[model samples]
Target: MHKIIVTGLTGFVGTNLKKYLSSYEIESLSVRYIPNQKIEINADAIIHLAGKAHDLKKVSRPNDYYEANFELTKQIFDSFLKSKATVFIFMSTVKAVADKVDGILTEDTVPNPKTHYGIAKQQAEEYVLGRKLPEGKRVYILRPCMIHGPENKGNLNLLYQLVAKGLPWPLAAFQNKRSFLSIENLCFLIKNLIENKMVVSGVYNCADDEVLSTNELVQIISLALKRKSRSIAVPKSIISTIAKIGDIIRFPLNSETIQKLTENYEVSNKKIKTALEIEKLPHTAQYGLERTIKSFINK
Candidate 1:
């Protein structure tokens, strides 16, 4: 069995990934940002998932992002360069490239990250890529968008809660499609990257093949709850005004939340799929989403 060292084993993605890769010899490595700290790697592959997540609350300091995302990554990656670890997988976010996608985001898209979080991740990516790899070593930078799965308490969970409460979705007027990445698909891709020698090392955008509107997500939630989906096409202008008020009141419907609920951030997984030699991911968008919703309902 190929022993794999995984960081962030307690996080949503890390927990799911550990279960998904149960067949492999997995070791959990707890990491924190320590300046000039030397890390030791004793596995064939290391999946670096221990980084600061994008804070929607906006309470995190700018330096926190750089230290956790950039500095820690630089340190570990430096260790990988010297260690016997043959494979190094860095879990980067799509935000590292663009906060909002103008078109279907591809690997070719130039990075223009506006937030400190994105900028820090981008810096880590650059550091990894800028270094020359040793012979027989492979490095992969995965940019996943809106990863979701069981036990995930992201925006998707909030939406599921709204539907479970039988509250009508009020932002139906906003029509937008956003790409999502299933934890299963991400784990599958990572497993393939570790096991397959033919897979080239480079940046790859990870997302489900199909893009779904927020309305579609609501419907999925309702289906999982066995309840009728309800939506009100409140005017965009009216919703915008309400969201602005929410920003002042610190309510649930702030401007940031509104934009997140109604944004067209499509990511292309064509590169990853091609690398895996598969025409499509093992799970369809609906299938994966339904599974996620069911997990929410069961909980």
Candidate 2:
């Protein structure tokens, strides 16, 4: 049996990975520092998912991201180099690449991370990419976009509530295409990468093949909620002026909310597709979104 160690076993993605990887002898590791030498030496693969998530509230400490994301990752990765671990899978984010992409985000894009969260993740990628591993061993830096699936309780839930309550979405004036990764799809890729020996070491972007507009997302959400979509088209100019005021007033449609609603950053899954060399991934993007929405409705 393949021996694997998965950190952050309680996280959204890690929880998905653990249930999916149950066939393997996977150890659930929860640590803020380097793991034990015994586990370090014995594991066939190490999928590191533990890290400080991006703080949207902006109330978090400045260096917290660096300490939790960069320092902790560096500690484990450095120890992995000294151990017999054959594969080190680092869960990075497309945010580490760019704050805003002109088009689809690919593996080749230059990293220009905007937030402390993004910067810290990029620094961690740099730390791993800077090292050389033992022969036959490989490292993968996976930059996944906004991942959503079962048990997810964040901004998506708020959107779901709007759709569920049949509230007219005020941001329908915003038109943007965004890429989202299904936690199922991400786990599928990780399992495939670990199982396939020919899959070499390098950075890869992860997402479902499809890109959908936020309007389209709302429609899917509406379908799951079994309700009519009530997205409205207020004049953008008026909204922009109101948002400028709301920047101070902290209205729901303020600058940050506008960015969240209107920013178009479609991550390309083409590289990962070609890398895996399969005709289709496990789930379509729309299918995944609909599933997640339904999951929320059920909850």
Candidate 3:
């Protein structure tokens, strides 16, 4: 069995990835923020998931992103270069490229990250891609967008709570399509990358086959809860005014949240699908959302 060394083992993605790789012997590494620290990497493959996540509240310091995402990644990657580990998988984000996608985001999109979190991740990606690897080593930089699964307390969780309470979705007037990543599909790809030597080493965008609107997501959540979806097509101008007021008082329906709800951030997974030699993802968009909503309901 291939022994895998994983960082961020306690995180949502790491935990799910470890569980999915049940046949492999997985070891979790404890990482510190000290720069130039010597990391001990003794394994056949290394899955680097450890990084400072994007803070929606915008309360984190700029240096915190650099220390946790960029500096720590540089430190671990340096160690991987010298170690015998043949495969190195880094968990980068679509945020590293662009905060808002004008069109369907592809691997070739030129990155212009605005946030400190994204800038740090981009730096880490650059460091990994700029290195010259040994003959037997392979490196993969995966850029995943809006990952959702069980126990994820993200924007989806808030929507789940709203639908659970039988509240009407008010932003049905704004139509937008967004890409989402299923935890199961992500794990499948990671397993394939580890076992399949045919996949070329490079940057790949990871997402589900289909893109769905937020209104569609509301329907899915309602279906999972066995309830009727009440969608209200409130005027866009009216919603904007309310969001402006919300910004002043720091309410739930603020400008940022409004943009997130109504943004068209679609990502293309054609590159990864072609590399994996697969036609469709393991789970459909509605099916994956239903599974995630069911987990929230069960809890």
lDDT tens digits, residues 1-299, model 3?
Answer: 28999999999999999999999999999896895578999999999999889987789999999999999999998999999899999999999999999989999999999999999999999999999988978899999999988888688977888889989999999999999999999999999999988888899999988999999999999989999999999999999999999989968898988999899999999999999889998898777788888889888
Model 1 alpha-carbon miss at residue 239, Å = 1.2
The candidate that wins on lDDT is 3
Model-by-model lDDT, in order?
Answer: 0.91, 0.85, 0.92
**For model 2, what is the error of residue 8's alpha carbon versus the real structure, in angstroms, after optimal superposition?**
0.5
Residue 136 CA error for candidate 1 (Å)? Answer: 0.7
Residues 138-253 of candidate 1 have per-residue lDDT tens digits of: 99999999887777768787798789888999999989999998888888898888888888889999999899999998998898889999999999989999999998996888
Model 1 clashing residue pairs (backbone)? none
Residue pairs in clash, model 2: none
Model 3, 30: alpha-carbon shift in Å? 0.8
Model 2, 1-299: lDDT tens digits are: 28998889888888788889989998887777443433344688899999999887889996888888998898888778888888999999999999898977889999999899999999999999998878988899999999988788566876787778778987787789898888889999999999888887999999988888888988889888778888789898888887899898856668777777789988888877788888778899888888788788777
The C-alpha stretches of model 3 lying farther than 4 A from their native spots are none
Alpha-carbon runs more than 4 Å astray in model 1: none
Instruction: Single out the weakest 10-residue window by summed lDDT for candidate 2.
Output: 33-42
The residue-level lDDT of candidate 3 at 268 comes to 99
